[model samples]
Target: MLAAAALAIAGVAYSSWIFDFIVPTGQDRFRSFLSELEADDVPWHQVYSYGDIVAGVAAVGASLLLFGVRPAGRGATTAVVALGVFGTATVADALAPMGTVPIVHAATSAIAVFSLFVTMGAATWSAFREDNWPIMRTLGATTFALVAIATGWMLGSDRLQGDYLLGLAQRIQVGAMSVWLLVFSVGTWSSTRHARRPKRVPRRR
Candidate 1:
């Protein structure tokens, strides 16, 4: 279930790039944000909006599963709660369209991003404390750093040069999160699988 949710989140988040190849959105991949594809003016914008809704729902489900599977620790609890917030804010972002309600959209987007950062940071802390799944810990740290750098670049591009890199930066940020989620999902599945495996009894001697 968690793996499915992770896939849904990653897929919907990056599907804009796939749509770019097949659709004729008036928005530029470099200058425009992915949200532009879901704007009222764009063709099939409803699809993008629905995708966000699905992704957000999936993220929330994953958070529930995380809560169930996480080791006993406040860090793990924090991670789960933060992920739920991220998911909720993502859905709110979709509800408040960028074109119709730019201010609300921006606010929700900020909340989503901030919550994702908290989710990653707290998850990494929990992972290190557990002293297992080193790869997940590394991926969480890397994803957090990448998302921060890309988001900073996207926000600063307007002052530095232009908004040319805004879309690219946002894409990179989402991509990092997607990669981390994929790895985490797989790791979690593996752990659950191992835990469920039945131990064989040795033959009586």
Candidate 2:
């Protein structure tokens, strides 16, 4: 499901570029903010908006499954909430376009991005706690840390040349998160019965 979400996200992003719906995402002349694609009444922006909504909804399902698989774990709960927030933001973001309602759009974007960071942390901690999936844990933690750093740098570089890198930074963050989620999803849902089950909480040593 998370993979589907990632595909939906990438589809719209690529569509935007293919149709020239907005400036190319990573160029200096291009704005990094996803809202810009739909905010200014760009043509067929509803397509982009709805694409985000699809991604968000799929993520919500994946999160819910995580929650269901391990309701007792605090990490699972946190992941649920974080991804839920991300899903909510996408809906709110689509409803409030930047041009018609700048404040609402900005608020939703901030909320979504913030939730994304939290989601990464929660996912990393959850996988890292499991000894069986060493590779998954390592990749999750590494991606989480690196994306967190990039997000921080992007947030901190206000009014500087660093701001110019916002496009790249934002993509990096999204891409990293997508990779972690995709890999984690695949691992969790592996065809092997042993791998299909969620990792249970280890007993107290």
Candidate 3:
């Protein structure tokens, strides 16, 4: 479980790096789109869009860790929901080269919105358990949920004004949150293994 979480985190970090360095660098068309919006004095939707990308990836990665560590029914549901959102977003992005429209953006936007619900549901469920580190679990879950909600709202409302700084910050947040999940998973796995060890018996005279 811990191992899985660690890998998920690593995946999130790698994805973040790709988005930060690679995606933006070569995206001339996308950048032009943002520039046009700026010239027209429009709010930067590009920034928010990129933010959603990073957040969606991080949410899925964290969901995987939560599933492995807790294995709760709700956790599985959350994982599925997160995956659905990420898949939707990927499809939308792939189709962007073809054209941009309300339909395409709407389809992709749904992913971000749904992710918020997934994170909230999962976190709420996890909070009910009485565990060794209940607080940490709750905190992590809450943090993910809130981030999901914020990103979802930004995407859904078209409030992302395509600011490079905003996009960068969003990516950083996603990557950092993912790292937390990895650490938590490793700790959970280690603790579980330690607790399962057989106890030594005393010999009687």
Candidate 4:
């Protein structure tokens, strides 16, 4: 459980704030996509690529651990699988950088984003079905809703403005997903602890 939590925290460390710190001059977080930072011409492009790889590995490790200890239900199982898919696709995205292979990068990026959406949505549904950890469940539902909204806005922005606001939209979408991941980490920890607790017994009168 501690390992799982650590992996989740490592994944969250790839947040936009960290990216902003490493981002080179002339790269606008609000105007340029995160992938732009991994371009060949960008200074320390390897740092951006390595960050994605680390975050992707962390996501995969956390998902595997959660799968082993996740609540016994199909919804929870589906959520874990979705998270794995997201992580795998993210790794692929890093390998196929937009600067090197635009087509492959786009495809992998789509898969990563879609799977992340599914991860949050499935987690919310599973939490509701399991009826455990009210706080986590509530957070799951709220973050899922926020993520959905952000995704929709991001897609719409891409279609309408043609990249003017796409970067901002993507950042917001990822921010919401990060929030969901944090809640998921807490829920996983709680679930693991619950599973290990000794069952209570009535004392003899």
Candidate number with greatest TM-score: 4
lDDT string, candidate 2, 5-99, tens digits: 44344324323323332444332423355556664456666666776677666666656665556533566467667877887786787788887
Instruction: Itemize residue pairs with steric clashes in candidate 1.
Output: none
Better of 2 and 3 by lDDT: 2
Top-down lDDT ranking: 4, 1, 2, 3
Which sections of candidate 1 miss by over 4 Å? 1-17, 159-164, 199-205
Better of 3 and 4 by TM-score: 4
Note the Cα lDDT for every prediction shown.
0.74, 0.61, 0.46, 0.76
Clashing pairs in 3: 43-161, 44-160, 44-161, 44-162, 45-160, 45-161, 47-162
Most lDDT-accurate candidate: 4
lDDT value for candidate 4?
A: 0.76
lDDT of 3 by residue, 59-147 (tens): 45545554555544655455445654653564354345224465655565455445544644553454455343243365656666555
lDDT of 3: 0.46
Error of 1 at 116 (Å): 0.7
Query: Which parts of model 3 have CA positions greater than 4 angstroms off?
Result: 2-14, 18-70, 73-106, 130-139, 145-157, 160-169, 180-184, 187-205
Q: What lDDT does model 1 reach? A: 0.74
Superposed on all Cα atoms, model 1 deviates from the true structure by an RMSD in Å of: 2.7
Please tell me which model should have the higher TM-score, number 1 or number 4.
4
- Candidate 1 lDDT, 68-177, residue by residue in tens: 77655887788778878988898899899888899999999989888988977877887789653455677657777887888888878756864458778877877777
Better of 1 and 3 by lDDT: 1
Cα error, residue 83 of model 3, in Å, equals 4.8
Question: Between the candidate structures 1 and 4, which one is better when assessed by lDDT?
Answer: 4
